[model samples]
Target: MSQDRAAGGRMGDSSLLRRLNHAAALSAFLEADSLTLRELRAVVGVSRPTAEDLLSELLAEGRVEETAPPRQPSEARSAGRPARYFRFRAESGYVSGLDIGAHKAMAVVTDLRGRTLATHRVELDPDLPAPERLQAAVSAARSTWTQAHLRAADITGIACGVTGALRAAEGVHDVREGPFGSSLAPYSLPGFTEIDVAAELSTRLGQPVAVANDVKLAALAEHWKGAAQDHRDIVYMFAGHRAGAGVLIDGQVHQGRHGAAGEIGVFPMLGWETAVARLHARGAVLAAEQGIEPGREGELVITSAARQDPESLAALIAFTEALARGAAVLALAVDPEVIVLGGGMSRGGAIIAEPFRRELAKLTLVPLEVITSAMGADSVALGAARMALDTVITDLLTVPGS
Candidate 1:
């Protein structure tokens, strides 16, 4: 038994070494564009014999492609000869990213560098049971992945941003009605519980998976590539059918103690309950004053109010003032360098942005730079894809199997 176990250990190490060699060779070939065995060794940090052994394995895997860049002989300053370089055939692999929302889901496929090669979006029933909804979402992703002419094996990692809070300990999230509702039991949603989205998709395609809160993912997207580009500390306020926030401090997301830190929609008196109600009230008043039909529940009648109906305007102003108060509290707590207003309704642009700034100014002595989200309605989804890509890149570069 001991001899057999020892043999198994040796086999495992051999397989791992092969994988590591492939990864290192692939990393150098793709990143450096071309690399010799020595450079591959440096990247892999392995002995020459080990590297050679692994290179043979990679060749068998068809992961490394030999390149014959015209080599020029050195003038022999030290009597040295030129060496051949190799490149990884990364074109052989691909990756996918998915962004799941309450009512919609978006997916994107990209090559190793994160350049988007294809994208897709589909509407979904949020009311569906968690598992079913997740299945629907996964189906959508798979459809899009197929459209992109890529399979699951092409996927290296998946980063997903969910609408609910990702519980700190559970690799899952807790879905609540709002900050005030009964804490729902743990959910088995795709990005939340089963984490099965990745595993299931991996079974279909073969890859690792990662997940994050959609809002936090959006904040990361903005921090890395969008509007909040200038400031390290920022409060990203995303207001839509639902309102929430994402906090970035020193270029990192602060997920709060309960994984609810940026759960601004639940921020005490200013939580989702109060803020959403205020907005709904504004919508109701606008409906009454302008004789316009009431917008659906939780949706503000922005068009009616913006039309300059006196009563509706007053109600809208009041709602804006309440939002300003929420922003003020955020200012006091995080002291974010910039407060970014984003989400669906935020597309009303100055309607919410300018007034929000003025109202915030009235409450606090410290003036804050307030701006609309540059990413707009697609911000969350785009951020989710970016988050997925970030995970794939990180894992490919850092972790062994990923």
Candidate 2:
């Protein structure tokens, strides 16, 4: 019995080594696009025999394929005819990114490399039932995938960005349901109270779907591919339908104990809720309710009106000040290098940026910058994609022999 147990341990050790070798070989091929046996051996730091065995495993798994002889990077590395090269089958899997809001639902399909394969957007009827609205989001994903000439089975994972407070233990809570007097986001319908939105999307899409706060996701997008890319630590102020923030410290998003770390807008002293209330009192909210559109429309009206009327300009400045005041608190706490003004109000161009900077300068002695978000509205969805992409890659990396 002792001999049998020892034999089993040896088998397990061999299996583990083979799995590690397989992962290394596959990763090296992906980084180099394609690799010959000799090059792969050098890249994975494996012997020729081990590399050959790993390649055979991958080929059998349909993950690597031999293609036409591409030009090699170096010559005379080996003393034989050029060996056949193998490339990763990047098409073996797909991923998706989704942005869900009361106003619009958008979906983007991407290959394993996170390249945008296709995208689709649909205006939603906010008055619709929650399940129907969610289905619309799922349909949009399907449409995008179909446009990419891919099927449902091809999608390995999906990530969604939604307008709400996402708690780890309880899932998401839409801001509209909170005690705030003002409707900050374009939250048209009554929202789900305590639903596992990620699980819901995953069930509907037939793939793993992860969910995150839209503003938080937007900040991530900024860090990953937008203006905040230059800085490792950033405070991204999301001024869209609602006023909030997404903080990145040391290149990772900081989610507090309850995922409410950046919910500064809820403070009555900061004037986020009051700012919108004041704007609504000035007839901006009326325009939105009167079928003018949601999100950016009210801001545009405010922007254009501010240029001509003193009241509009004063209101805008007051709102901007409130936004800056909230940001000052975060800046003092995190001391980030840059503060990115993102979300709906950011689309106001210099109109929003100037006032925010002026107000922030008055409140803090910190040497910080206030810059407009270069990512615009697409930040959340793209950031969702990036999050999803990172997750899928990590998941793949963890799988034995992947």
Candidate 3:
């Protein structure tokens, strides 16, 4: 019996090693567009036979495929036969992300590499009931996968970004109780904490769904592919209809014990609560002067400021000054490498950047490099897609039946 137990342990050890090798090889392919057998062997630190075996397994699973090697320069080209190459089948599976906000519900379907294949957006009424709002979000996601010409089953992962702070517990109420409740909830949707957002979306979409605060996800998106890609520590501020912040420490998003790490806007003393109102008030005046509808006051103000309208520019400065107050608090606490301004208002370009930076500089001890988001309105959704892609990769690397 002891001999049999020892033999079982040896077999288990061998299986673990094989699994590790398989994961390493697949990870290499995922990182690069393509790889040769020799390169795979070196990357996985395995024998030629083991690399070939791993490749066969991946090929059988349709997660990898043979591809033509790139043509080399005439002088660098070898005289011998060319090496064969294999590439990860990014199209073998898909992932999706959803941004459910007060104004709209946007969804994007991406390949395994987080490339957006299709996106769909639906305008939503903030006053819509919780159940209906969730349905709308799921429908948008479904539309994206359908537009990508893929079935629901083809999507291996899904993540959604929403307005309220998410707790660490699985099904806890997301809405805060006091005056500090979700900023957008009063103006947009109601009773957001009444339902299990992830569970409801998962049930409707027929897949597991990961949910996070929209601002935090926007920060993640910026780090992944936007303005902060070069920086490891960052402060992402969402300056749109509402003001919020997301923090990244050492390249990882910092979610506090309650998953509300960067919620500085909740403090009235911080001035974020009044920032957007100031912008809207200025925008309303600009819209009236321009003879446009009043509801788009924010856009009007931003555009007028860009054109160097004196009143608009002054109002923008005031708005940024208010924004700087909250940002200063975050900067003092985190000391990030950069502060990235994202959201709808960031589209103001230099009109927004200059004042925001000028104001932030006055309030902080260190001169913070403030940049506007290049991702614009799509940052949150793209960030959500990154979250989904991360989930997919995690599952891919995991050994089956482990």
Candidate 4:
């Protein structure tokens, strides 16, 4: 009996080692883009035979593919035949990211490497019912995947960004009704407090869906491919139709125990609650003068401010001051390397930057570098895609047969 138990233990140990080697080899292929057999062996710290076996397994699973090596320069060519190379099959699977907001539902489809393949946007009424709003977001995602000429079965993961705080319980997130929830009240039906956004989206999409606050996702997008890529610690501020913030500490999003780590705008004393009201009031007048819909007021205000329209510039400054107050509180608490301004208003970042910095400086002990988002309106959706890609990769690395 003791011998039998020892044999079982040995088998378990060997299985664990094999799994580890498989994961390591796949990780190397992901990071290096492509690798030769010799390079894979060195990177994964495995024997030649083990490396070949790993490659064969991944190739059979469609997770890897052979690629032609780059042509060698005439002088650099040393051998009669070139070594073969293998690469992660980024095209093997795809994932989607979605941003569901008061005014628009946007979706982005990306490959395993997080390359955007297609995108779709659907305009929405702020007063639309919650169920219809969610349906619209799903439709946008489906449209984007179709635009990429891919089937729903090809999507390995999906993620969504919404307006309110998400409380996680047993791997599921429930949208908590709070200040942000009140802001979303116009779009929500009765019993909004009991809604499970992640579960809803997952069921609709026929796959597991990850969900988080939209502002937090925007911060992730900025860090992944936008302004704060060079900085590990960042504070991301959303300064368009509404005010919100996202914090990254040590290169990870700092979601508090309840996932409200950067919800400074919730505090009434911070004045973020009324910040966009200033822009809206000014934008209303500007829109009327230009004979446009009130929805375009925000853009008109920014454009007018750019031309140095005194009234419009004043409104922009007032909005900036109110926004900076909330940002200063976050900055004092987190001391991030940079504060990234994003959202719809960031399109006029140049006009908003100076006044925002001036106000922030007055409230903080040290000056902080402030930059605008490079991702613009697509940041939240892009970040959502990153979240979905992470899920897919995690599953790929852990499952025994995957």
Candidate 5:
């Protein structure tokens, strides 16, 4: 190689290092918007000159702004001038998060700072073809897009949470994998075996799109802003229409080989779904025998009935036992720091938490905290939003040009 070319390649290494440092500084600010020069240097772990150069590059890119006051009081006291404080400009772009299920689809719009701007939901005809349901989901997302006052092209990217396993190889939702139970099929048409979720959304909205398993996204949501926030190892179970689980190992969702890591419900020995079915059956029988109105949701009916009739109460305890059995099995294998109950059944916190925790305590030597989901039905969508936001931010930092 020529001397000039070899020397230029060496210069490129330093240039690349500076670009990486710039991205790191921007990321630090994104985590918590305001920071002083010293604080930025400490967080980014760079020399004073390197930190200043990185910050200057971010400011020039219009990603960082000098603010009047530091968010942390100590930073303000340490740095006399308010101009020393810098904050990330969060409003520069946005992302779309979508949750698609058998019955309905929901969408949430979030800014670069990961704040929800608007949300939209649309019901699907359970008997309708899959393509129609997909269209409905797209329409629902567009409704939120309209609410946010942005065209489809304005979005940086999209993340979608769907009802079945993520076929990463195909970039589609593998609808054949039934997490919601075999009795309940996913929203799909006869002709389409797999829903090309990423391609469809990206085509419809004019941006890159990504897809993930719904339960895993829900677990991610919990880790980000729910009961599992304090714990890195978590087993998050979704016990709504059917029983499903998502595992988090070391602050990351653990989707094992074939994306079937948490298919614990498939083993009938665990008895989580069986217990749920039994509870619903017993509730229906009791309602008919007593001539009382039965609640539509099995979870609500079971939990509410537990407060009344002795049989229903016993069934609730049994349900907890089964749930604990499944959880204990997972805990023994992975030793999660916490186990979270999410989805529809989790809304019945009082009836589920105490018994489940008590039974879990009996089964496992290593005690684990059990709690209900705080996000309710919105967990998957919110988690999808987090993923969407990450892609946008990743591109912002990693791409060659803004």
Candidate 6:
């Protein structure tokens, strides 16, 4: 991940050297309006020979590929030299991104450039036990394989985004706590075991699995592909049956020390807990009218609200306003450049953004930009697949015989 970089700053002596050494390799592959070795060398104040070496290294790593445009040889060069361009490999090996939500799991197969090729979704019994639920996610991935028209070998890696705090491998409570304290203590997920899920999925996929909070993954997707692209710091908030937020600082997702940094739902608001309960209770009542059991685990009380049934829409607006109140608190503290609204209920970003922006303006003096996520419900899944791709690419770089 990139660190906190000062934009538009004058290049320092050593910094210029480093940038020149790396720019040809990485920037060349990325899409740009126009680029050339001469231009890159000029930016770094390096000699032509040094620039040639940098380009050579990039070509050796297969990071950049040269292409010749389809044109008459006479048109190809105005002064004498032929024009050759470079592009990042769009058809590189595939990555599988997965999102394990409370009631559903979705997986998307994408290329190195993050273009989706195929997708798969599955409805799971939210009331079922944890291991069984994980197995359902595995099944979803396997089904996606066929849908994508790719063999298992074509899948380079898998990334998983879940809804809980994941402890480091050493922290599992496999033993009793000592006089000081042991790493192994039971971590709870209402219907799943975190360790078990990670272990089972890793084993089933035959590759390492990265499990992170779902909202964090959503924030990552926004940072990678949504309105947050211009801002290095951002906060992604979702208002639904459950409310949550994700933080991104310096282009990296901030999970905090314990992975609970963005669980904004637990943060106290003005009678927020009560209001949320009432909202869910209202949803349950409505679901009952449709013959859905009030206590069913997968029952979407909030989904029903966001569908714009007159009374439900009214309730949802109140919730969005209340959510804005919570966001105001975050804005005052972090002061990020933008806040992205996401999740199933956030479909009407225009409606929600207008009211939330109005409410936020009343609370803070700082200029805050609010926008909706382009990835929407697919954010976590895309992020997960990216995680998987990272594992495979990283191994290919480091392992002796990958």
- In lDDT terms, which candidate is top? 4
The residue-level lDDT of candidate 5 at 381 comes to: 88
Which should have the higher TM-score, number 2 or number 5?
2
lDDT of 2 by residue, 161-205 (tens): 887735343543443444455533333334554455766888888
True-structure lDDT of candidate 4: 0.83
lDDT of 4 by residue, 207-287 (tens): 889887788889999999998999999999888787788999987778877676787776778766566777788899988
- What is candidate 1's lDDT per residue for 1-402, written digit by digit as tens? 332234346666655545555565556666777777787777766667767776776667766767875456666334457576666665655666667665677776666655667777777665555555556657766886788777666666566666664535445344444444643221223334434444554454445455567777778778866788889998877666566677889987777665666665544565446556666776766457657654342244566566776755555566566667777777889898998877777777666667778888988868889877777445655666666665655565573542
Clashing pairs in 3: 126-188
lDDT, candidate 6, 351-389, per-residue tens: 667777888888887878888777766788887776666
lDDT score for candidate 3 against the true structure = 0.81
How far off is residue 302 in model 3, in Å?
2.5
Clashes of each: 4, 3, 1, 0, 2, 6
Q: Which one wins by lDDT: 4 or 5? A: 4
Candidate 1 regions off by >4 Å? 1-93, 125-132, 167-181, 184-209, 281-300, 399-402
- TM-score attained by model 5: 0.81
List model 3 lDDT by residue over 217-261, tens digit each. Answer: 899999998989999999988878777888999987887776767
Every candidate's lDDT: 0.64, 0.75, 0.81, 0.83, 0.75, 0.65
Worst 10 residues of 5 by lDDT: 183-192
**Cα lDDT over the full model 6:** 0.65
Question: Model 3: number of clashes?
Answer: 1
Better of 1 and 5 by lDDT: 5
Write down the worst ten-residue block by lDDT for model 1.
Answer: 182-191
How close to the true structure is residue 269 of candidate 6, measured as C-alpha lDDT?
Answer: 56
Between the candidate structures 1 and 2, which one is better when assessed by lDDT?
2
The per-residue C-alpha lDDT of model 3 at residue 275 equals 61
- List ranges where model 3 is wrong by over 4 Å: 1-12, 167-175, 178-188, 281-295, 304-315, 399-402
Number of the candidate with higher TM-score, 3 or 6: 3
* Cand. 2 TM to true fold: 0.83
